[model samples]
Target: MFDLNCNLRRGISRHYAIDKITDNHPIVKSSKKRIDKEYSKFAGILIDVFYDYLLVKNWEIYSDTIFADFTTEIYQSFQKYSGDIPPAARQIIGCMVDGDWLISYQHLDGVENALDRIDYRIRAKMGARIKLVDAMLILQRESIDLERDFHAFFPELQQHILNFSLG
Candidate 1:
């Protein structure tokens, strides 16, 4: 999944020529290792974060029925794959599965709150000073473009995860 996200970023970068990372190079391999390490440390939090963004924003594209019900079903699939997620994310997933955080990323405040929670956990565990506000600003700035890319990317990702879970 992390590799998929990285590849998606690389694909998106081709259009903008904004990313510094190059694909299939030694540097890219090293970067992916670092990325994988962070991902494992976070224990699959990015999967929920990215999927939540897609589920909320692209809800209409994926469903013609009630949003809540559709979200429930999708999240249930996520729950089946939640064993690898860290304890912190497991708790968040419980809330999300129960609809407590239903589409929170739909609003700026929700984004901030989510970033805060992530920053808190990462800081607690690693004592790293990840300036979440800085991260939030980048997301806010490129939201439109990012959403466009996400719309193009998320469906395939959803299917991939579902297939992986079933396998």
Candidate 2:
């Protein structure tokens, strides 16, 4: 139990570190800036989702494994580690696997659906009215630039993780 708790803490710390690195990276910041002012406040969240779509769309360039196989493996890992996962994350994992959310990142409608869900959550939790559903237009308009930024940034992020692991 001690080891399990330590490992969970480490994993959560690493997740936050990666998020900070991604959020502060210059290329990522530029990608956020490319989004219209209407979504300036939510640009980070939108870019994160958009980047997932980009990653899935360009998966062949980054990984030898089939995307479906990769996502399946991830879902299996979630199940395998279900006992160790925090309750909140476990709930999300259930929804993600049931909806095939990772695989859905490859499609425009899937991306729109994700944004809509986020919008709904924000409205429900914060009473903030946001039209993240309309972010699809911005995504379409800025895809070329966003993809270019992603290509430049992802390799750096991979290296950062490698270094983080080694350290």
Candidate 3:
């Protein structure tokens, strides 16, 4: 099994995780669902969406990219219940670097999207907040020492990420 220790960051109830890839215990288990109400779902989706981009850019995902790619969900996770309850899926990001898997998550608190039929059980399903300025992340990967460059380059996303946490 892949060691999951030291692969997570949390604020209040929010979290970001970077998992070392493993063939023994795949980071994305075979018993999980695509729309499962877990926060990690968000991580899974993000890595997939950006897999080609990450590869084309040639950024070595350390044992710490916090995002990985695994494209298959032909199985069911543990949380599947007997009753046909409404699905409350969360958004997460996952990717691969040097064959290591990374995962990122955002809690679904204070989300502007109203839940019409979602129950409290799955309503707390945390996910990433789709930001308007994520288009600039492509530039952030250009350098490990992207200090002032990002601050000056992507002030909008930097501010939004900070403000979202504060607000």
Candidate 4:
């Protein structure tokens, strides 16, 4: 069952975040443009924060699957800072072990708004763009791995997600 109000695209996994694809909401449309403009600033912060974590976590030398996954994650995070794009928007991050798309497309409107607000604050504080793509890539890759492992280890948790509210 697809939850249109939530971020999930129809027929995808629970972890998916199908963001305003083919959407026509006026506010969301406007935010999309602004968010795209400031991705560098937000992505940069994510990269820097994740880079530090990578160094401490010692995942600098990750597997190709993991690295590719991470790289894709950073690429997708551009939408995150894009205020118009919902937090639950589905992103094509990497391949599952089986080669299907490992995507995230569930959006929490509140969470998405909060992230947008944070991005605004960061941009205002810095007064310039930030370029932390390297760090963001790593962080996203690791997160994907974490999600995969988590779901694998606790399949039962899916039930809770299914019942969660999108609003």
Candidate 5:
């Protein structure tokens, strides 16, 4: 299993540069809150939405270059934080990198396959079934809204990562 804590530590070490990351660091505290609010509880939906956003948005930052190259680099960087991710997620990561899945995830069939894989992994690793039908229904019904949300969310995330990297 990928270790979330370990990956977070690696991220902090790479970015925050605190002598030590304790429960007291603002980033650490904010991370906890953000994880609890956004990821810990709503990971699947957020992930799909984020994935869609990455694909559909214009992202002028990459106006002169191929976005696939950027995603390819990001995938390679995942090894730095590989400690915390689950084996299933690790498999998905491999598929994403090997398949250039960020671009593939933009297509309808790719989205379906991604959701199916997520559900399958959840069932296999957690012994819990996540009914993807409802999620799929939402995707079909609120795709526009979801795209708007992605447009709003992903750029900010990109900026944050960039700022963190530059810090």
Candidate 6:
């Protein structure tokens, strides 16, 4: 149990490390910059969600397993390890699974819904209003460049994770 806890902590640390790497990567920065100036402050957040959508959109290029099957396995894994996850994350996992969020990422409506939810949260927490829903228009307009950036960046991220795991 102690070893399991330590491993979980290590995994969480690796997750954050990977996020830092992604945030700092030049290609990701380029993708973020492609967003409209109105959304410059939320560029990082938008890029993160946009990349998830792209990953789902291009799932066949990256994974052999069907996307639905893959998402099912992920949800199951979350349930299996629910006891190890923090309470807040568990709640999020519940909502994610219930909403089929990962599967929904493949659709434009799902992406819009995600942006709307983020917009609401930002408004509530920061008392700052931004038209995040309109971000979909920018995403659609910049789809080609953003997709190209994702293709270039994702392989490098995968390699980095592999190296991190090996080290």
Per-candidate TM equals 0.53, 0.91, 0.18, 0.21, 0.56, 0.92
Candidate 4 Cα misplacement greater than 4 A, ranges? 1-121, 125-132, 140-147, 153-157, 164-167
lDDT ranking, high to low: 2, 6, 5, 1, 4, 3
Please give the RMSD of candidate 5 to the true structure.
8.4
User: Compared to the true structure, candidate 5 yields what TM-score?
Assistant: 0.56
Model 1: lDDT to the true structure: 0.54
User: What is the per-residue lDDT of model 2 for residues 1-167, given as tens digits with 9 covering 90 to 100?
Assistant: 35756766777788887899998999999999998998999999999999999999999988899999999988987886789988998998899999999989999888998998898889988998778888889989999999999999998888888888788
Give the residue spans of candidate 3 off by over 4 A.
1-69, 73-86, 90-131, 134-142, 146-167
Error of 3 at 99 (Å): 22
> Taking the tens digit of each residue's C-alpha lDDT, what string does model 3 give over 1-114?
532222122231232212212112232232122222443344333332333233323334312342233212201211222122233321111112211222211111111111
| Candidate 2 or 1, higher TM-score | 2
Q: Residue 38 in candidate 5 has what lDDT?
A: 21
RMSD of 1: 11.0
Best by TM-score: 6
Pairs clashing within candidate 6: none
Against the correct fold, how does model 2 do in TM-score?
0.91
TM-score, cand. 3: 0.18
* Candidate 5 per-residue C-alpha lDDT over 74-145 given as tens digits, one digit per residue, 9 for 90 to 100: 787777666666798787787777877677655666666666666686678787654443355545555565
Better of 3 and 6 by lDDT: 6
Judge candidate 4 at residue 137 and give its lDDT.
36
